[model samples]
Target: MTSTPGERERRTSERVIALLMLLIHTRHGYTTAQIRRHVEGYAELGDEAFEKAFQRDRALLEDIGVPLSLEQPEDADARHVVDASALLLPEIDFSGAERRALLHAREVWSETRLQTEVMRAVGLLVDPGSAGEADDGLGLPRVVQRLTPNLEVFLDAAVEQQVLAFGYRTAAGAVSPQDRPRRVRIWSALEIGGAWYAAGWDLDRQGERLFRVSRVIGRPEELPGTGSDAPARPADWNPVEIRDRLLGQGEGLRDRVRLWVAPGRGHSVRLRGQAVTPTAQDGAAPGEGWELWETDRPAHDGLVQLCGGLMGVVQPSAADPDVVAEVLAAWRRVAEVHDGAPPPHPELAKPRQSRYRQGQRERVSRLLDIVGLANRAGGITKVELADRLELSPKALDADLRDLQYCGLPERLFPGWLFDVDAESDVVEVRQAVDLPAPIRLSLPEAHRLSAALDTVAQMPHADDEVAPAAVTAAARIRQVLADVGHTGATTSVRPSTGGTDDPGDAAAVVPSAADGGGAGGHEPPATPVTSFWDVHADQDTVRVLMDAVARHRVVRLRYHALHSDRTTEREVEPVQLVQSGVVLYLQGHCRTAGAMRTFRVERISAVEPTGEIAKARRRPKKTMLTPVDTTLEAVLAWHHRIRDLADDYAPRLEAQDADGRRLTRLGLLSEDAAIALAGMHAGDVEVLEPAELRQAVRDRALAALRRLETAVRL
Candidate 1:
């Protein structure tokens, strides 16, 4: 593994966790022995390897930030069961904007340092959320295709731990530093700046270095793997420990360096006046004098500039004068980090593989301050800190050890003490870290067992294109159930409100996804199953036709009328897709229909021979069948509100059902028709037409009520 042992370990641990989540949800929960057996199958190695790997994995899951829980109920008490319900997977919530942000990150990583695992994670999170399942139907073929071109090449190179000879380029246009062919192991493929960069360990050079993806020349050729190159630290590792280790590596600057500030007309520097004590001369004349320090330098420019202006450094020999400029340049590059357009499906945007922030160092230091507020007064047990911080016993143990090393409290026994090192994994503390173990998970049935969870976890968010994602998800759930040949499992689609989930049983794990299902809480598992079949063609084709119609282009259609006996061909200019009752009716100047008539999609012969839009053709002016504000958004909101009220106004909903017993599609018309429809649905329906249309409906309702009163008196 030319890649850092840390990277592999982290990925392996994530894989283990992902697997465990799938298992727990599938088997409800498992015991320690069951977990060990099941985890061994997820891992490539044997029993010994699995046991060692599992112990480390268990500790990592319990760590702070990772956030997992363990429990032993009164019934499962003696079994040491792993309470998978406490996984807190549902606690992870991303806002619509945040969901959008995650998709944009895909473009950012389109090819950059954060490529492989980070990009994969992002894609995994987003695809399932939006567009039901990210597939060719979502029109993200380009994304997958683009990534595909180099995936196998990189994967092969990564696995081989061999030197990959290739040409390289940099954004700075820097050519290769080496004149001759250099042998090096490709450590990782990076996706930054919407471009790919393959960073590798230069055998000739011992330090870590970056490469620009665009500049790479020649086909990537991988050599054979080497034994020394595949050295391992551990197959399982804790991210918190890794972070702590990175911190402990050290910090300090020996020289006082001058830094030039950027061009900001009114930018002022803020200082932590209480923290840095000043000398007489340095304190008196800030810009003209320099302060000396024996510790690490402040990385933030505001602080650096404040420190510099308060105590100026004398321009000396050799230190880079462009240091400030360099930092500023990096800042400028990152300012647009979250600015890219979201992936077509917002769900594709997920949290990063790893995050790097300049201010994290300060945050880490502040952790010490926070700990002091609690422990310094009266020592807290590992369990207490664990509960407060929501850390697991193993994590609490590690935190305690780290605290102990910090000269806090000593000994595990309760006392009014706080002089123990946090780094110490005390035997007592480790033993005290009691947690529920895993339950029986069948590895052989992992995929089938996780169907519902996959659907829930990877659902889409409300966005443009198609109908409300909730409806689409409901439809997709039907597909999932259909695929599994289980029509008995009814589904109800509900909006995800970022709520806590039902605990313990896997079947109770019903999550509100970005989009797809039936009445909420049929089961609590995350359902992220992929829809292998294409469902978006109808909507997509309709969109294309609508675009052509708007642009006055002659479009070809390959329509498959689901209700019709067969598919058919047509060439027409679409005017509008009308909501005729509950079904979508296309109102176009159809060559076949021969008039400005509406054809229900369910009845239209398949739209065949769909090709390029003939934009030169002129479209006739017609009534706007749908609301001008009928954006993907307004439309979704309209439907979502209607669905929400259906439960409350079942009678009204039933009235519109056509079939009296079932509450099916509730139809909404253009503003003109909404009031008339409201009368049809009545108190069984409330005109939830966004207040813009409120008075119109209320007036009509009042008028109708008056008329009814007049008739009753007669």
Candidate 2:
């Protein structure tokens, strides 16, 4: 495309203004060695080039319409840094006409920058005869290239709070979003994929706006615009704050948000909302009926838009409709675009989400205790629950205090306090409160958690703690339950009327505790049991193991095995440390095994670090109870086969839609030490290769069934 003489003149003027504005934006800033680093990259910069650049930039910026204020640097950090307070710009807001003009500009010249190269690429894709012209669809690439660079520069401008002037193009070839493109001061920008984007209050567009760099046709000027320039802000403006005002979207905004959703859309609503919070009519399971999201703020509008077709907003905040209209417009325009539309605007998306939480469980139970105990018996004493969870009197009080703040706006939800009734132990559940299916905590089950957490809760708080490993210990418990093949599992835990059985409270995995350096994250699979405690592990033991891992040391152990019903002493090399749930298990090579194995940390009678090794041995236990093919080659082959089989076997086969879910259960041999031959990933199984081992499991299951039937009397 050839530029008209008029367009050529306009282009030259825009570039000059851009360069000047660039210099002005950098005025208040100063740094050492800047000359060497920043001065070398441009087309033709000199020894005094940078010093000249800054001055020229300021002059050019003022020549436009931006009025920038900068204070002289103080002697202290003068040579190295610029003071922010001194350099400031006036407020800026785009008029409706200006925004519309800007949007028009964006539509037109957005691709003109790379027109030359872009056309060449298109020529390769489409024949002139077949396509009529090579440039038919080639313009998009040109626009796409320029937009990123301009957006990148603008993003930097936003972060730095510096003024910028660049040519903006509209759909009808107008330079401005309004009637004509004019030199303007851009105060800030937004960041995406390490690049900057500048979306602001467009005076021409009449609302918030987004500008893609691809549409910019001129260089950036750093100086504030002067007298005749229309871009300068009036004095007394906080550009940075203004930027936030535009980009903040709706933080902490509340509205009586009403969403009318279709029946099947309940799950969609929860997932889209990114939290299971159903803002329905005061109390009820989210999907049982029409879903309502009672938001304290303006976040509700986004949800309504997302659930569109299946949902619509009712009696929303005044801002809702406008925002909705904008979204729908964008959706309509981009929805069917498979040619890869630009990334969606971050300003439009909901803010990054916080982690999910489970607040209702303890709230209900504690509410039961509060109403049942306090109102009738002057608040149940710590001693009452002391024997139940095996908690100390002081710990019981701590637990109660924990339940107190659960669900108030301040705490954020039913406050966790006296919300429970102590007399009948009835919780003040709303009319919609559905009684939770009971949770069965067998003493044995509780004991496993108790033993696992027993060691962790007791560990001396380290100055700096690494990741927590309790989940691994918890996984062992879960695996056992899964093996039990239970579904819709519901059981009740009866409090002991007898005095406290001090298995010790092992509720460390409780949701109430969320620590940055605590029990969550990935763990490698378990090593075979070489020296693990066949018995139970206490909390103190869990902590010891964690310490061993962090410090990279070995411990002398006195381990008890339930299989042999005996105890043995040995020195084991601590290898990989694993934490599952509240229990800490060591998956290190053991001297006892002559290889690696899983050692329950709590069961170790004592831990004495003879020396510390920086690296832990990374393999499974060498010793085994049964004489199995133990060579590395054989182990590898077995591990490979099992994985292949697991892929096919994991999903059960059944006759009906629901028949196969539970009845067609498969259990692999995990207890035998030899079963550990499979690689670590098979924490679920130890058969080395899935392909062959699946057949072996069938053979074993049949044999076991036969044995069981024969034992039964007719």
Q: Tell me, what's the RMSD of every candidate?
A: 31.8, 33.2
Alpha-carbon runs more than 4 Å astray in model 1: 1-156, 159-162, 168-179, 190-201, 204-219, 224-268, 271-279, 283-714
Model 1 shows how many backbone clashes? 90
- Candidate 2 C-alpha lDDT tens digits along 512-532: 111111222222121110001
Local distance difference test, each candidate = 0.33, 0.31
Decoy 2 TM-score against native: 0.23
TM-score of each: 0.22, 0.23
lDDT of 2 at 40: 22
1-714: candidate 1 lDDT, tens digit per residue: 287864454345334433334343433445655554444243356778776766665554433123234556677632333444442212124444334434433321222222332332333233323423322122111121123234335433433334765554333233354554435554434321122334445554543344443345456656566424432212221122211121121134222343221221101111111123443322221122333232223222222222222111111111333543343332222222212321121111221232332132122222332243243323444443443333467645544544332221112123322245455332222211111221111111122222222222222222342223323333443454444343322142321111101111111011111111211212222221111111111344444444544445655554443212234566776655443112344666767666554455433424533554543433335433333332211111111112222321112122222111123223343553444333322222333324544445555444433332332233
Backbone collision count in every prediction?
A: 90, 121
